[model samples]
Target: MAFLEFTRLDERSVIEYVKSVAALSSILKLDDEGDAAEKLTVKEIGDGNLNFVFLVTNSVHSVIMKQSLPYIRCIGESWPLTKDRAYFEAMALEEQGRIAPHHVPQVYHFDPTMSLIAMRYLPPPHIILRKALIAGIQYPLLARHIAHFMANTLFFTSLLFHSTLDHKRQVAKFCGNAALCRHTEQVVFSDPYQISQYNHWTSPYLDPDAEALRHDNLLKLEIAILKSKFSEQAQALIHGDLHTSSVMVTPESTQVIDPEFAFYGPMGYDIGAFLGNLMLAFFAQDGLVDQPDHRKAYKEWILETIEDTWNLFYKNFVALWDEHRNGAGEAYLPAVYNNPEVQLLAQKRYMAELFHDSLGFGAAKMIRRIVGVAHVEDFESITDAAKRASCERKALNLAKMLLKDRAKFEGIAQIVSAIRQF
Candidate 1:
């Protein structure tokens, strides 16, 4: 359990491992000579696909310990992955924490050899944002908080704040996390469109829809551009899997977790992943109830969240760019962008492109969740197959339209209106 090398840790063994590490044992007050170890409890959590997460707690303080399995946990050893994702997760936590510590968990310890990391525990009442969405819980401040997070994290890491030398060095380092990036390319960008064995849907209900996607030449072309952008763009450090489940939240707190897929990629990938999942939650509301408005007004709230998230993100992101204009960022220089009018136009053009990119990426994310290997529980928990399929089809159709015509969408309000049409 307390081995010096990597071993698959379980409840009993994890306790021994924790007690062996002072930083962890200190939290539980575990003294080798005392009964403190016995008082500590270890509860395994997370339904995630890649890691083993456990909550090790004493009578008072608690800490979360996570270890990466060398394979996908949900798919098992058939799909082997690198244990080194723990290293990237640690790196991302450190960097993102530096930029937005309030939104990210603190890393107390990282053991590269063991592929393990221990960090601040987000206790009860702090639920996974996806689960909370399905449960119809609302975080009134979620939009503002997420805006601050994306704006600062993306802006601070990009050329606007970093010199080319520093940015490229960081990018080169993250290139080591190629395994996860390749996996994303497959699942998110590739598998869903082709006849991949891993792809599945509501089966007979979505069989036609899936077939339609497979044969849609224009849609395939659209996705191809996005996949290439994902492969080539190094706009900023993005939380590659910024879907709803990667977030933990309460009424007053919103914590972003799982940057295991973090990389230097298109900033809109993160923005789109978030907004796409929120859209999924919105569509799932339709099939989620036997009676209309069973959770009355929840859909409207979801719509507001989607709209608010984009709008606030736009505002905050631009604010940061303006504040740091005279700073060290290389993308836009005070000399070249010398005038007030030129700067205004540059910012407008940038935000407009980002807005469309977010829509396109968000739509792509929605497609994958429904028809790819991993499905969101929002639709899964709908119980009745027909109802769930009904929900999924609407989301699927909307996603297809967005992917093809994301450029046509002028604003978040228009996207919200389109969501209602389905």
Candidate 2:
């Protein structure tokens, strides 16, 4: 087979492309010496707004093949996006996999020209976390596993682990991902606050609320600050889209996928995205209720999960800081922060800021899902408009409060209490 030029792949073309690539064929044991190619099955499974994902499998082995199209999948060719996002996704996977191997999938091969990546396939019993949350299914290790993943990946990639020279090198490398970053800035921060064609809601029910959001001066001011930090703070190499849908989980195994928006940004941005989406799921539970009790216990569980995720992430992140305080980390020098009093003060101040950032960013994510272009299934899957709007309004109100007064929060417990009160 000869090397083919860049072209959008379909079900038929994927098979030929796979067979032509020795690395992919070898994964399925489908080389000239093997017969798997004759019996191979390929299924297109991408349901995202950005890429084409295929499940390629044979009788004995399987791998996931993801190819980036030159445009946004949901809006069609009218919105031209770079297929080069695949390259960034592959790079992030390799780097994040190195830092948190237990939670990241392994990459087998990458083709820059084709904008494709062949990687490990997470088989059955593994499903998107958002789907599991909607079904009210519980994963025992989800909180612990995700906490560890965030801590390791963020800590190791930040100035706390890397010297200034190394950190700058990485920051420069990811700057090319500005396009995706711009998209996030628009949808997550800018679009919701203005009258844009992409902005939407549950219609008449949320019309007034959406309008108020556009005119709220305090909310706009707060969001502008967050936007500035998001663009200026290169604190770590973050999974820029760490929502529930980006996570794949079973009772024991957790894997993160689709890091096409990976970039050097505030670590709290990543933490906030996950926590915010979980909150969306929590509020949407009202619409999913079938009994009079209205899933009270499940709601409590969701709140607890939110509290646990943040508390665990803080504990683990602080532990990493402690363990590496005397190492080559350039953020806080041992000579300057050597005393116990100073270390305690520094850690306390650092944690306080992070907590606020997480709350603010989380609130932004919640607001975006309700009024921004891309809505979450947690709210969208509900069949009843009135019920969905009610749940979304509660979420939207809570998010507004959090975004404006996040600095008042001292701990995750306080945030959880606020959610309950709302």
Candidate 3:
């Protein structure tokens, strides 16, 4: 019950806390073996902006404990954040894991009092997908697994599967996640556009480009439209921060983590976030193509993965919508779309809009990574400043185009083609 005091955990304190909690202590086999708790090893490995992540292991088992502080970890205590984000994270993971168990890590225990969650620790070789992409590694099943994850998670949480009454209840429950949602709205959709303290870039190189973004009236108009959807649309329960770093993968496994920012929002927001990060990875390849690390083929693979992910998601999502056309979903009544012709027409219209939404959101994600508060390691790892700037400019330009012209793009193939041209 000491955890009920709400003091932040240190190495010494975490061991004491674990010894006091049966759910965590049992996982380390402390009950079966008298000395198990004494043999446990714990190391803090949080590198993200928001939370403290510790990897705890005994001889036979390991678990990841994530604790949210009352402020942004990267920005320090001056920028306060709610530690209660852990509650929403635990809730989202449980719901999303039910829909896509294979793609999500199992949540073993969650401690709301301590603002902590203990989950399955992804073992070595299951690196973050962003790191894998940066290393020029190919995950053969990456596209298929991610597409399946997006389809199942998005469809099952949306109006396609939930009745109007149930959907509203779910939405109302998540609306309390307003703090994290506002963080996303400011960082992703707002900050990079105007002068803000958090915004930075490959400065002298992108000086004009960054200034141009501020003054571009047309671009601001488009961003305003996308921002409205991000704030207003409750189409589905989305993994709010679905960037590459949020995914852990190997040749065999792909696991999504960090739903602390999760809430009900536009489904395309999740899909676009993943695709956009992949595109950033592709752009950063040019900077990494030095010596034996020529990443031309890997760059091609990233593009292919991006194209395949969207294409497969489309196929699977539409299939789900068709299969459940007569279900409890209240989006399109069965009587209204009963005829084959109307059903086909509805499908086409729905898909077209989703595709455009995905493109626009994806483009915004890319732009933010390059010039916003948080920069991606894809470009950051490149030591040469000018070389890094070049890669970033290409990505930024491509993203701007996509944001403005996404409506013209009919499919993922066309988007892939534009990436190639850039």
Tens digits of per-residue lDDT for model 3 on 1-422?
A: 37666879877677887778888888888778467877888899987779999888888699898999999998899889999999999999999899999999999999888899989999988999988888889998999999999999999999989999999999998999999989988988999999999999998999999999999998999999999999999999999999999999988999999999888999889999999999999999989767525777887889899989988999999999989988999888988778999889988998899889988999999999988988999999999999999999999999999999999988888888999898
- Model 1, residue 367: displacement in angstroms? 0.5
- Deviation (Å) of 353 in candidate 1: 1.1
Any residue pairs clashing in model 2, and if so which? none
Reference-based lDDT, residue 17, model 2: 84
Candidate 1 lDDT over residue span 312-341, tens digit each: 999988989889999988898898999999
lDDT winner between 2 and 3, please give it: 2
> Ranking under lDDT, best-scoring first?
2, 1, 3
What lDDT does candidate 2 reach at residue 414?
89
Give TM per candidate: 0.98, 0.98, 0.98
Off by over 4 Å in 2: 1-3, 32-34, 292-294
